[model samples]
Target chain A: MRATVLYAAGDVRIEEVPDPVLHEPTDAIVRVVRSCICGSDLWPYRHMKPDPHGRRMGHEFIGVVTETGADVGRPAVGDVVVAPFMYCDNTCEFCREGLHTSCRRGGGWGIGGVDGGQGEAVRAPLAEGTLVTLPVGADDPLIPSLLTLSDVFCTGHHAAVCARVRAGSAVAVVGDGAVGLCGVLAARRLGAEQIVLLGHHKERTDLGREFGATDVVTERGGEAVARVRELTGGDGVHSVLECVGLVDAFETSLAITRPGGAVARVGVPQYEQVPLGRAVFMANITVSGGVAPARAYIEELLPDVLEGRLEPGRVFDRTVDLDGVPGGYAAMNERRALKVMIVP
Target chain B: MRATVLYAAGDVRIEEVPDPVLHEPTDAIVRVVRSCICGSDLWPYRHMKPDPHGRRMGHEFIGVVTETGADVGRPAVGDVVVAPFMYCDNTCEFCREGLHTSCRRGGGWGIGGVDGGQGEAVRAPLAEGTLVTLPVGADDPLIPSLLTLSDVFCTGHHAAVCARVRAGSAVAVVGDGAVGLCGVLAARRLGAEQIVLLGHHKERTDLGREFGATDVVTERGGEAVARVRELTGGDGVHSVLECVGLVDAFETSLAITRPGGAVARVGVPQYEQVPLGRAVFMANITVSGGVAPARAYIEELLPDVLEGRLEPGRVFDRTVDLDGVPGGYAAMNERRALKVMIVP
Candidate 1:
């Protein structure tokens, strides 16, 4: 089997790797139908220190079950499935509570000692609980969009849900990445009255508008806050979707939020400290949101995607064959493509 | 008129000050009948640098309206009224939104140029908006309880409300000060079933129990978090009222809150930054709370206070004449009294 491997920063290659097999009673073997590079993947792609044995790459994928272990009942052989960003036992207390991201008995794919998703064949743990069937053929053109349910799309949906976005809500999305653009769509589907997209890129902002952004602010920092306020009649927004983890994004999200409002963030914060005491208290603001419990939300949002009510697959602006994975990384790193889908 | 003035770390004196006069269309003059020494007052009482012109010393008071400007209505001259901890124009956009603490046209008393509540006669700014009538005489024993509406009781209530305390919720009140004690009562009034009071002081803890504490954790820091966890069947509380803004208190509050729960804080935070991003995100916890909007809450709670259903006035453990305020401060600093009620 061939898989994308990262030996060091700026060093990505598609190389022959041992094919994955069902290794445990709860494991299943999946034949990768679609995969994609994530924005977070860039962090290590640009800065990871050298490692002797190359590391596994990619955690987002949708595929078909080729084989399953004895204990796995669901996701039978030949079934098309979506693997959430991580694998978790659905019976855990945390999973039962709908916080699969914090699942007590779960682990990340392609991270730690697990196999990566950007390969011809991969092993999925907790197969019965983690795999969601698509009820369609894997060769469908909508595969790219369905693959997104593995991570980014579900993440954006989590951000919207946590922000309490609904009819009568005024929301501001603070990022232009694929996830942020999806957030605009999620907010729109939730019936938000006004959606403000904060980004400078024409390509991204245009998509954001189509996704349901009623306004766009090209400026950053304090100026961006001012623009959001101006757009909302000086009252700011009832909800803010912070999809970037940068400190400045966090600050802007908090600044543009009205009193008694919420700032639901899905970004992994980069700062060691958030000076939110006085500001949060004085305005009666609720500072919440966190890592998207993608698995918990996959089933709930799957219906919308399958019905063609949402087309998040548009976020994949380009596609690459298995061997062209390197160029895909280059294009995304150089900002030439919003996201690149991988067809093996 | 006489006023309690802080001239230095240890110099508190009853000094003659000019009588107050209404200087604004919305102003009124109130003859103070009662005032209270707050825990925050000690911040300067024990640390302020020496100065020739003493600083004003109080922000909690219940008084009789002796005069009103032509524009003022509602509470006529001679009516007993309670002044909120701060003055805010009820008509501002912030106030109209029920966030009076962040009112655009208001300022706090006893800070900067505003008159202090400890004075014999106070020129109340935004009088019509800041004062709530008691519908009773000053001679009523319930005067001490109504005086709490000016700050402590209302502040505690704000903490409960912000923490989203509702029926069947388990709550933890952090801090053993007057505000924290009141928080226990507020949580009970809001329908919390299991209230955990975190404080070691026997005197204060006793009052906390009377106010509705079902459990008491006499530890601080890490140990305190363990205690709270053990008390809640290791699942943590549904809500946390952080009445102490110290870093340890903040950390303990977050540590003891369950995922998707809220922590409502009221005390002024005593730290530069709170590294809350990762902790808050992973658990889906919310950190909110700040200065209480006392004026906005007084009316909703007045019936309870006036009917003797809530006796938060009992938090004032001692009383002293204007000249003996210095002794009152000494007793509180020495831990001889939980709080002191000032008879002006």
Candidate 2:
């Protein structure tokens, strides 16, 4: 089986790897049909240290179950399914509270000897709880959209939910990445009255507009804050979706949030310390959102995608096969592709 | 007239100052009947730099309207009124949104030429917006509790509100100050099923238990987190009201918050930066709350205070006359008194 591995910074390769086998009664052997490069992957791609033993990559995928352990009751052999970026038992107290990312027995893919999604096959832990069976076949035209249920789309929805976006909410989305664009859609779906996309990329911003961004601000830093405040009539927006985890983006989110507003961050932060100072405190601002509980959100979003009310798959502007995994990473890292879909 | 002044850290005095006069069309002269030293006031009492011209002290008071400018329409002369710690025009957008602290034309008392609440009389800015008329007389037994509505009580309510405390909520209050004790009361009022008070002070924790703390954790730092996690069945609390602004308190608040929980802070932060790191981000913890919008909350909380349903004034364990203002500050600063009331 061919799988994606990272040897060091800017070095992604597709190499033949041993096929995965079920190691637990709750496990299932999944043959991946679709996976993609994530925005977060760029972090390591830019700074990973050299290592003789390469690291497995990828954590999003739609696949078909090839085999299952005796105790795996759902997503039986031959069933198509989508797996969230992280695996969890779903029955833990945290998972019951709709926070699967914090499940007591949860763990991430491509780490701790688990199989990565960007491979021919994956040995899924907690198969019964992690995999959401898809009604449609692998050849369905909606595969691209369904694939997003694994990570990106759910992440964007998490941002909107955390920000408390609702009808008549004035919102600002701070980023042009696939997640940001998806946030615009999510906010709109949640009935936000106004959405301003803070993106300099015309191509991405154009799609952002179609996805329900009422306006776009291409400025950066202070200028961006000023522009967003101006667009919202000087009160700033009711909610800020900080889809870019950079410090600058976080600062901008805080600056452009109105008094009593919220800033929801979905992008994995690159910095540790945050300026939660007197100004933010005095303004009654709330900062929330985190690693999305994709498993919890998939069911709610699936109906919309299956009914054609949503088309999150539009974020994938380029596609590659298993051998092109390295090129896929480069395209996204160089900003040449919004998101690259890997059809293996 | 005499007013309290802070010349330097540990230096407080009752000095003769000019009588306050209406300086704006929206202002009114308020003769101080009751005021109190706040937990936040201790901040400057500990680190204030020496000044040739001292800073005016005190921002919580219940007073009588002595005179009014032409534009001051409410609280006619001779009316007893309670002023929020900060002044704001209630008609401003932020004020209308219940964030009076961020009002467009708002300003704080005891700063920028405004008369301090510890003075014989204060020139109340935005009088119509800042002063909420009291039905009771200045000498009413309820004076102490009414004075708390100016800051402490409303501040605790703000913490509970921001933390989203509600029916069945598991709440943890991190502080034993007047505000944190009030937070315990507020959480109970909001129907929290379980309330934990994290304080080592027996006297304060006794009051916290009376106010509705179902449990108390006396341990500090990591032990405190462990105790709280143990009390909550190892899952942590759903809401953390951080009334201690120290970094350690903030960290502890985060450590004991369950996934998807909120930490609401009302203490004037002693530090600027916060550890909004990967752990906090990954747990979907929300950090909210700041300066309380006392003006916005006064109306809703007034009835309960007046009906004997609340006794926030119990926090004031000591009282002094105008001449004893300096001693009052020292008493609170040295922890000899829970809170000190001024009967000027």
Candidate 3:
């Protein structure tokens, strides 16, 4: 099976690797149908994070199950499915409390502690917890949206949920990438009457408007906060979704959220000092959310996608063949594409 | 008028100062029947904050309206009153949202912001919003408890309310001073089933126990979190009240709160760098509370104190006459007294 592997910085390659097989009774082997580049992958790709020996690429994917272990009950072979970026048992106390990302024993894919999904075929651990059966046929054109459900859509929803977005509330979304763009959609779905998207790029801002962003703040950092405050009658937005892990994005998120409002941060935090004391007491803001427990929002958000009530697939500005995986990574890295979808 | 004046750190003197007159149409003059030293006051007395420069001392006081300002309504002259340490116009939007401490007009008393108590006659700003009339006679023996309603008691209730403490919730309180001790009582009133008081002194622990602390963890920092987690079946407590404005206490408060729980921080933040990125997000904890909007909770908490349903005054271990106010500041500053009440 051909899979994307990283040797070092700027050394992504599509190489033939051994096909994955069901090693546990709760595992399943899926033929990757569609996969995409994630913003988090840039950490290792850009050497911002240490590059381990023989690292596999990608975590977001929609696939067709090729084979299921004996213990698998729900997802049948040849069934189309969209798997959340991380797998969880879905029954632990943490998972029961909607913290599936922190599941005690459910670490599964793409993360350093888990396996990767950018391959012709991949082994999924805890099949019951990892896979969500898709209603679309294997050849359906809705694959891109289903592919987004694997991460971006659900992550955006989780970010909005963590921020407690509600009807008639104002929301500010940091990061104009797919997840942040989807955040605009999520906040709208949750009844946010006003949405502000902080984006430097015109295309992304346009897409954000399509996703229900009523205002676009092109500035960043303190200036961005000032712009948001100007839009919100100087009180700042009622909720803010921080989708960029950069220090400026985090600070901007905190700065733009009104006092007593929640700043839901879904960005994979890079090394940075978060001023919790000032934000906690001085601003009286609530800070929480990371590694969005996408599984928690999947069941709730999937219906909207399936019913065409949402078009999160707009995030996939570019699509490529399986052979173009390396190019997809390069394109996303260069900011030439919002996201890259690979059709296997 | 006799008042306690601080010319310098540790240099308090009971001097004859001029009687306070109405400074604005919104200000009233109150005769201080009873006023107490607060933990926050010690910060200035010990030079932890800026050195005192010819200012009055106390902020917590229960008094009688000797004179009324032109705009003052509700409280007539000679009415027994319990005003919060800070004054706020209750008609403001921020006040309506229950954040009276952050009222738009910069409403706060003592610490050189406005004329403080600790005098025979103190000028009260936003008089109608600041003063709460007591139903009992001015000579009621409940003066000590009612005096607490001016700050610590309601500050403690604000901590619990901000933390969202509810019936059967497990609560951990950091800082065993008067405010923290009162926090235990506040948690009990909120119906917390398991209350842990982190204290080093036996007297404070005894008071904490009397105020409904089910357990006492004298250990500080990481060890304190361990003990709290041990007591809470390894998951940590559902709510935490942090009343010590120090690095260790703040960190401990964050450490002991369960994932998805709240940490109500009422301590005046003295530290600059509050690192709260990965660990905070990973824990899903929400930090709330500030200067403990005492004005917001006084109406609800004051009646219980007057009826003897709550006894927050037990925290006052020492009492002094107006002429002995200078010695009272020294005792509390030297750590020989938890709190001191000055009767004029």
Best by DockQ: 2
Model 2 chain B scores worst on lDDT over the 10 consecutive residues at B325-334
Off by over 4 Å in 2: none
Ranking by TM-score: 2, 3, 1
Candidate 1: interface RMSD in Å? Answer: 1.7
User: Cα-based RMSD of the predictions, in order?
Assistant: 2.8, 1.8, 2.5
Recovered native contacts in candidate 3, as a fraction?
0.50
Q: Model 3, which residues run further than 4 Å from truth?
A: A48-52, A111-114, A277-280, B48-53, B111-113
Give me the candidate number with maximum lDDT.
2
Q: Each candidate: fraction of true contacts kept?
A: 0.68, 0.87, 0.50
lDDT on C-alpha atoms for all candidate structures: 0.88, 0.94, 0.84
User: In order, what DockQ does each candidate have?
Assistant: 0.59, 0.83, 0.53
Best by TM-score: 2
Candidate 3 structure, TM-score to reference: 0.94
So what's the TM-score on candidate 1? 0.92
Q: Write the per-residue lDDT of candidate 3 for residues B266-303, one digit (tens) a residue.
A: 88877766666677776677777777778888888877
Better of 1 and 3 by lDDT: 1
> lDDT per residue, candidate 1, A283-338, as tens digits?
77777788777888887888888899998989999989898899999899988999
Residue B233 displacement in candidate 3 (angstroms): 2.6
Interface RMSD, in order shown: 1.7, 0.9, 2.3
